[model samples]
Target: MSEGKVANSNRAEQREQLSVAATATDGVQVLNPAGEIDHHTGDALRHALDVALTAHPRVVVDLGGVTFMDSSGINVLIAAHHALTQAGGWLRLAAPTDTVMRTLQIVGVDAVIDCHDTLRQALAD
Candidate 1:
């Protein structure tokens, strides 16, 4: 492959890996994030959580589309979780990919936060 073509392909992949959304259902907010969560996008994720929390007290973060997660991403989540808890609200994680889950486990965060297998279960609880 040509060098230019390779660079374009890499850029496309990175673009495709960046996405985040917040949806509300039954008074619960669901943050559906897609892509690799790293230092570059952790701020965006944190902002999304802040916006969601403003409207909905209960939040369920759908991590099914998250392909990768780093320490910065985990810090954003932990901060959100703490903020929600202080406000008498709840923040839960759902459908984390193997890589993301492993990262959480390695960091010992799984024991501190509530994680569910699906968004439905997370919201229902």
Candidate 2:
């Protein structure tokens, strides 16, 4: 778990806010985000996605560690999805908590992007 942890040096002092790896799962880039994602921390997620996409367009954002999310996070995902799709790749969301899942559902992002109940399912698909 300690492996492939992308430092949060560019975003915040809390390094645990995001963990990223180009090939964390089946050669697919994975981003593990923790804590609440809001206006203040949304840029961190965005930056993480930017870095992830540079290595590979396909990415799976593991949201199991995320507790809360707002419009800012949704916008970040939408942008990342657009970028990946344009490159002939895709973005997948995995293991979102109930609250976060509800946020995605309410925003209709669940319909636009692929959402999975588990990280395994997301990567397997």
Candidate 3:
């Protein structure tokens, strides 16, 4: 490939690495977020939620690929959860990594939100 083409491809890959990608499956929107969801990437995660909410009332954020999460990440989830609830829908977390799960528990968010072991379980109810 040409040098410019290779550079463009690399840039695209980097962009993909920075944010989560979501898809709809069986009336549930499954968001597979990646990378670190700190202040910089939190907006991306929120945007993903916004987009997902538009299509499906029920949204499941599959955090299996998330390597790190901070307060901003927690805030994003909380806000989305509230928004979904206000709309008479539900936003749930699925397969959160140990770190993410611990953070939620520590912040008392675990009790406030619904979390499941898998997307299938999240969607079942």
Q: Give the alpha carbon lDDT tens digit for every residue of 48-100 in model 2.
A: 89988888878999999898889999999999999999988899999999999
TM-score of each: 0.90, 0.82, 0.83
* TM-score (C-alpha, index-matched) for candidate 1: 0.90
User: Candidate 3: TM-score?
Assistant: 0.83
lDDT of each candidate versus the true structure: 0.89, 0.86, 0.85
RMSD of 3: 5.0
Off by over 4 Å in 1: 8-17
Worst 10 residues of 1 by lDDT: 11-20
Candidate maximizing lDDT: 1
lDDT of 3 by residue, 42-117 (tens): 8899899899888887898888788778899899999999889988889988888898889889998889889887
Give me the displacement of residue 77 in model 3, in angstroms.
Answer: 0.5
Inter-residue clash pairs, candidate 1: none
Residue 89 lDDT in candidate 2: 88
Task: Evaluate residue 106 in candidate 3 and report its C-alpha lDDT on the 0 to 100 scale.
Answer: 94
lDDT for residue 52 in candidate 1, whole number 0-100: 85
